[model samples]
Target: MLVLNSGSSSVKYQLLDMADGRRLAGGLAERIGESGGGGRIVHTSGDGGRRERTLPFPDHAAALGAVGEELRADGLGLDSPGLAAVGHRVVHGGTRFTEPTLVTDEVLEEVRALTPLAPLHNPANVTGIETARALRPDLPQVAVFDTAFHATLPEAAARYAVDRAVADRFSVRRYGFHGTSHQYVSRAAAGLLGREPSEVNVIVLHLGNGASASAVAGGVCVETSMGMTPLEGLVMGTRSGDLDPAVVFHLSRVGGLTMDEVDDLLNRRSGLVGLCGDNDMREIVRRREEGDREAAVAFDVYVHRLRKYIGAYTAVLGRVDALVFTAGVGENSAPVRAAATAGLEGLGITVDPELNAGRGGGARLVSPPGARVPVAVVPTDEEFEIARQAFALVGRSPR
Candidate 1:
């Protein structure tokens, strides 16, 4: 199976041998169609061989074609018979799509219509699906939505307390993002606890450049951090996680900022970078260690927001079985894991400092010997999850 995550300027792909869940090859095609764009593509094979090329490419089709050629060079072309289907990482599906869907004309049109819900994501997803379908007309393509997993959110959690008629007219409601990561992490947490997904309640914190938290009860997402967009959650690398709506109006009315300017401020110029001069957690940690007051405050704010959500989700779940951290920052930042759970001993949540500081690549407990709640670090594999979903869907298709 081929899992493709298409961004506005780049396409990230991974080819996997689902039979044994081993990665066959993967690469990225980036910098497509920008000014003086020298399209760059990097390919890595299963045995660790890598290749790269930089050249001018006009659009997604050209970039993808070159990527196919690179795959052909490794005898794993898109046309290979072994390739069953292509799975796409579509960022949003609204309330329409609730599962991995087989792409079709109607499906594509519906996804295109949903661009308003995910202006920065769904368009690229549509383009990727169209391009892949055109390239391999006979092959089946699946769209695995990032929002599909959160479709199960209860009305109380999903609805905004606003004028009902006006809210309905504008489709103004909470639709969480980072759902794929949340879903995978929650399930992996259950597995780490040696229990069925339906037997455990979990809170998954996906800390990366973009961060979000979710409360999963029996493998179903009941609550999530991001709402209506990916910008309303924990403090992220650049995006302001949660803020008063009045801030936007304040900036526009008093600060003489346009709506676009307000959007840019919240989505681009804020968060850790706004609080401090840096967005990278490692650098912020280094600065804090070196007695930088600004960095120390920023780190505290980030961790505080996380702890707040952890507590909120704990309430939502009612009986928390495990607290799991995933993604780039959550998996590697020992300080974050330790600090986020600190002082939560009253809630039966405590991270063993020595265990939290210990390093390993797999999911394991950082809680002390048989603590009340087990804290774990489970690396997320969204690509593999997409592949599994895509492969399962294809297997059930008519022969």
Candidate 2:
């Protein structure tokens, strides 16, 4: 399976053998159509060999052409008979798509129609879908939506408290993002506990630059932190999450800022960077160690919000068997993990200081022995999840 995550100016591609879930090859193409054309790509083969090159790719088609060439060099081109389908990461599925869908013309059009809900993402997704379909017309193209896993959100959790008529007219509601990561992490956590997913309850904290938390009950997502957009939940590197809606009105009416300005401020100018002029957690930790007050305050605010959600999700989930963390900061950044779970012993949550200080790549528990609620760091595999779903949908002995 070939999984493609298309952004406006870049494309991240991976070729995986879903039979054994081995990544045969992967690469990224970026700076597409930039003036003077210095598009760059770094491809990695199954043997862990890496190569980097620069080209003058004019558009997505050209960029993908280079990717195909790279794959062909590794003896795994797009036309390989073993390849079953291409899975696309479409950001906003709205309430329409609840599962991975085969990409038909009607499905493409519906995804295009969802642009208003995800103005920044769906268009790029549509372009990637069209480009891949055009490149391989005979192969199946599947869309694995980021919101599909959270489709189980009950009405009370999904709906906003605004006027029902107005909210419905504009399709305004909580449609959480990073669902693929949350779903992957939840099941992984269940596995680590030596239980079936249906027999376990867990809270997943995906704390990358873009962060979110989810309460997974019996393999279903009953509640999550991100809502309506990726910007509604955790305090991320750039996004200002969980701000009062009236803040926008205040900025617009009194501060004389336009809606676009307010949007830029919250999504681009806020969060950790907004707080301390740095977004990377490692840098923040270093500065705080050096007695930097600004970094200290930013780190505290970040963890304070994290602890709040941890407590809130605990109440939502009557029994949380494990607390799982994933993504960039969650996987590394021992300081953040220690601080986030510090003093939560009463909830059966306490990081083993010695274990938390150590760093390893694979999944492992950081809680002390026999802790009631275990704390774990499980790396998320969204690409593998995408390929797995796509393979299940259209992967019958590839033609």
Candidate 3:
């Protein structure tokens, strides 16, 4: 199966041998719409052979065409008879799609209709899907939505406190993002605890450039940080996660800023960058170590918001058997893990300094021995999850 995660300006693809869940090939095409320069694809084969090309990729179609050509060189082209299906990581599926579905014209139209809900993501996904269909019309294409795993959220947790008539008309409600990562990490965490998913409750914090937290009770998402969009979650690299809705009105009426300007401010100019003039957590940590006051404050705010969600989700889940962290910052930042779990001993959330500070690979425990709740750093595998779901949906049993 070929898993494609198409973003606005990039397409990340992986060809997997679903029989053994091994990646056969993978590549990335970045700066898709750029001109003059900044367009490239880095393709790596299963045996670690690498090839990079710098060329003009004016759109997703062009980029994907190049990807096909590269894959052909590796004997894993889209037209290969061994290719089963194409799994797309669609960022939003609204409430209509609850599981991986075989893509069709109607499905494409429905995904297009959802553009307003995911203005920056769904269109790119549709483009990838359309391009793949054109490339191999006879092949099965599956859409594994990032929102699908959270569809299990009950009404009370999904609803927003507002006028039902107005809210329904505007489709205003919580539709958490990063469902793929949360689902994968939660299940992985359960496995790390030597328990089945149904026997464990986990709090998964996917702290990447865009961050979100999920409270999973018995393999089902009870509550998540992101709502309606990816913007209503933990503080991100450039996005202001949670803010007063009235701030939008205030910016327009009092601050003399247009809605678009305010939107850009919140979405592009806020978070760690707005707080400390730098978005990268590593740089922020480095500056903090140098006694930079702004960096220190930004780190504090970031960790404060993370800790709040950790505490909140702990309450929500009642008994969190595992507190799992994943994604770039969650998996790599030792300071972040330490700061986020600091002083939470009463809740059985304590990270051993020696283990937390040590650097290693894959999911491993960082909590003290026999701690009430184990803290672990589980790397998320959304691409593999997408491929697994897609292959399963096509009635193929993975070896």
Candidate 4:
């Protein structure tokens, strides 16, 4: 199965051998719509063979065509009978799509209709789906939504405190993003604990450029940080996660800023970038070490918000068997792990400095021996999860 995660100007793809769940090959095509400079695609095979090309890719169709050529070089072309299906990472599914579905014209339209909910993402997903469909019309295409796993959220948790009639008319409710990563990491955490998913409760914190926290009770999402969109979660690289909604009014009426300007401020110019001048954690940490007060405060705010979610979700889950961290910052930033879990001993969460600082590649516990609740760093595999869900939906087995 081929899992495609398409963005506004990039396409990330992986060909997986579903029988054993091994990635056969993968590649990325970036800067697709740029004008002067040519785009780049880098393909790598399981055996470590690599091929890179720099060429003009004016659109997704052109980029995907180049991707197909590279795959053919690896004897894993989309037309190959061994290729089962194409699984797409759709950002929003609204309140309708709750699971991976075989893509159809209606499905595409529905995805397009949901664009207003995911203005920056769903359109790119639709483009990838369309391009893949045109490339191999005979192949089955599947959509594994980032919001699907959070569909299990109950009414009390999903509904906003706005007017019921108005919210319903506008579909204003919590539809958490990063469901794929949360689902994968939660299950993986359960496995690390030597327990069945149904027997464990997990708090998964996916801290990437965009971040979100989820409370999973017995494999089902009970509450998540992101609501209705990806911008409502923890402090992110550029996005201001949780803010006073009236700030919009204040900015427009008092600050003399337009809605679009406010939107751009919150979505593009806030969070770590807003707090400190830098958004990258590594750079922020380096600056903090060099006595940059702004970076220190930014890191504090980031971890402060993170710790708040941890406490809130711990209360939501009652007994969190595993506090799992995943994604770029979650998996790699030792300072974040230590800081987020610091002083939470009463809540059965404590990180061992030695273990937390260790550079183990795979999922493993960072908590001290026999800690009340194990703190784990589980690497998220959304592509593999997408491929697994896609192949399962089509009832196709790998060769």
Candidate 5:
């Protein structure tokens, strides 16, 4: 099965031969349809030799065509009869879909109806699906939602305290993002612990350019940091995670900023980059090492918010068996992990300096020996999880 993770500006594709459990091919087209239409796709084979190309890709459809050409060059094209189905990483499913769905005309329409909830993501996802379908009409296409796994969240956790009629009119509520990564990494952590998923309470921190924290009790998500949209959670590359709603009104009324400008501020000009003039973790750390006070403050602020959520989710879970970290920063930044879990000894959360910095493939515990609760770095595999569910739903694999 091949899984396609279509982002706002790129499409990441992986072709896996399930019969042999080998990745036949994979690649990505980045900076899609941008000015000058400059983009690149880096395709890799089993032996890890990468073939790269930079060319004009005016849109996602063109990008998909480029990807198809690359796969053909690698002799794993759509014509390969072994290719079962295409799995897409759709960012949101609202409350409608609880599992991966086979993409049909009706399903495509349903996804379009939910686009307002994810203005910046779902449309691009739909485009990718449509384009891929056009390229291989006979192939089964499946959509694995980023929000589907968190559909298990109860009313108390999912509800917003607004007038029911008003809220219902606008579909206002908590719809946590990163459900794919949280679900995948949390279960992987459970496996490492040698415990039944239902017996484990885990907190998963997916800290990439876009970040979220989720509290999973026994393999089910109970609470998560992201809500309604990806913009409502932890600090990100550009988006402000959480803020007072009145700030928008204030910005409009007093600061001479329009609502659109306010929206841009909150979404594109905020977060760690807005606060300290840098978004990447490595750059932030470098600035701090050079005695940049602004970067130091931003780092503290980021870790402080993360620690608070860790504490809050710990209380929500009553007892946490493990705290798992994944994504770009979560998996790579040792300092961030150390700072976020520091001073939580009372709650039995501790990270061993040596173990935390150690590396390996897949899931492994990073907590100090004798710690009451284990801290782990489980690299998230959303695409693999999406492919697994998509193939299962499409009957390409038995459930």
Candidate 6:
């Protein structure tokens, strides 16, 4: 199975040879369809040198073709019999598509219709699916929606407190993003705890370039940070998460800005970049250690918002059995793990300084000895999850 996670400006692909449960090869193409745009697609077999190339890729289709060329370069092209299906990561599925879907023309049309809800993401995903289909007409393409896992969110949490008629007309509601990663890591966390997923209550923080928190009660999604889009969550690399809606009104009325300008300001120009001129946590920390007040405050703001959500979700769950962190910052930033949970010991959340600050990896607990609730750092594997889901669907009705 070849799982393709196509983003707005990048294409990440993995060829999974499920016969042996190994990813035969994988690679990515970034900055698609942009001037001076070039990317490298790298293919690696287990325990060997990676084959890499740098070249121009003008668009998604061309980017995907380049991936195919690289796969061929390694003598593992898409023509392999082990290639069972292609799964795509679609950003939004609206109120429909609650489950992983096999891509039919009708399904494609539905994805197209939902594009307005995720204008920047869905079109690129749709184009990738179409291009993959064109390249291998016989291959089955499955669209694994980022919104699918959050379908379990209750109506009270999903609905916005707006005019019902107006809200319904425009599909204005919470459609939390990062469903794939949340679902994957939560399940993995449950497995690590030796508990049935049905018995666990977890808070999953997917802190990466884009970040969000999810409250999983009894193994099901009850609430999530992102509301309708990826811009409504934790302070991110480039995104300003969870701001007052009135900021928009103020920007329009006081700053004399248009809706588009406000959108650009909040989504691109804001967050840590807007605050300290740095997005990566490592750099931010380095600057802070050097007594950079701006970086310190930015770091504080990032963890402050995260702490609030952890508390809010703990209240929502009433009792949290595990707090799991995943993705780049979540998995790597031990300082973040410590600071975010500082003074939360009463809430059954604690990070052992030595265990956390020390070395090791692979979804282990960081909580102190005999802590009531365990804190874990589980690295996210969205592509692997996509491939598994795609393979399952294919096995049920093989193509």
Q: Count the backbone clashes (under 3 Å) in each candidate.
A: 0, 1, 1, 1, 0, 0
For model 4, residues 1-399, the per-residue Cα lDDT tens digits are: 999999999999999998898888999999999997689999999899998999989999999988888888888887889888899999999988999999999999999999999999999999999999999999999999999999999999999999999999999999999999999999999999999999999999999999999999999999999998778979999999999999999999999998899989999999999999888999999999999999999999999999999999998988989999999999999999999999899998999999999989999999999999999999999999899889988997545
Q: Quantify how close model 5 is to the true structure by its C-alpha RMSD in Å.
A: 1.6
> Looking at model 1, which ten-residue stretch has the lowest summed lDDT?
390-399
Q: Estimate the Cα RMSD of every predicted model relative to the unseen true structure.
A: 1.7, 1.6, 1.1, 1.2, 1.6, 2.0
Q: Residue-wise lDDT of candidate 2 within 21-111, one digit each (tens)? A: 7889998999988989999999999999999999997889988999999999999998999788999999999999999999999999999
Pairs of residues clashing in candidate 3: 175-228
Off by over 4 Å in 2: 395-399
**What are the models' TM-scores?**
0.98, 0.98, 0.98, 0.98, 0.96, 0.96
- Runs off by more than 4 Å, candidate 6: 35-39, 396-399
lDDT of 6 by residue, 1-399 (tens): 888988877888888766655767787788887788566666665445587777778878788888888787777888877578899999999989888889999999999999889998999899999889998989999999899899999999999999999999999999999999999999999998999889999999999989999999877999999998889989999899998999999999999999999999999999999999999999999999999999999999999999999999999999899999999999999989999999898898999998898656688999997889899999898988888888888774322
What lDDT does the true structure give each of the candidates?
0.92, 0.93, 0.94, 0.94, 0.89, 0.89
Per-residue alpha-carbon lDDT of model 1 for 1-399, expressed as tens digits? 999998888999999988788889999999988778688999998999999999876788988898899889889998999899999999989888999999999999999998988899999989988989999999999999999899999999999999999988888888898877888888888888889999999999999999999999999999999999999989999999999999999999999999999989899989999999799999999999999999999999999999999999999999999999999999999999999998999899999989999999899899998899889999999998898888999984321
**Tens digit of lDDT per residue, candidate 3, span 313-333?**
988888989999999999999
Q: Which residue pairs does candidate 5 place in steric collision? A: none
Clashing pairs in 2: 175-228
Q: Which sections of candidate 5 miss by over 4 Å?
A: 35-37, 396-399
Which 10-residue window of candidate 6 scores lowest in summed lDDT? 40-49
Q: List the residue pairs that clash in candidate 1.
A: none
| Poorly placed runs, candidate 3 (over 4 Å) | none
Model 4 TM-score, 2 decimals = 0.98
Model 1 per-residue lDDT at 265 = 89
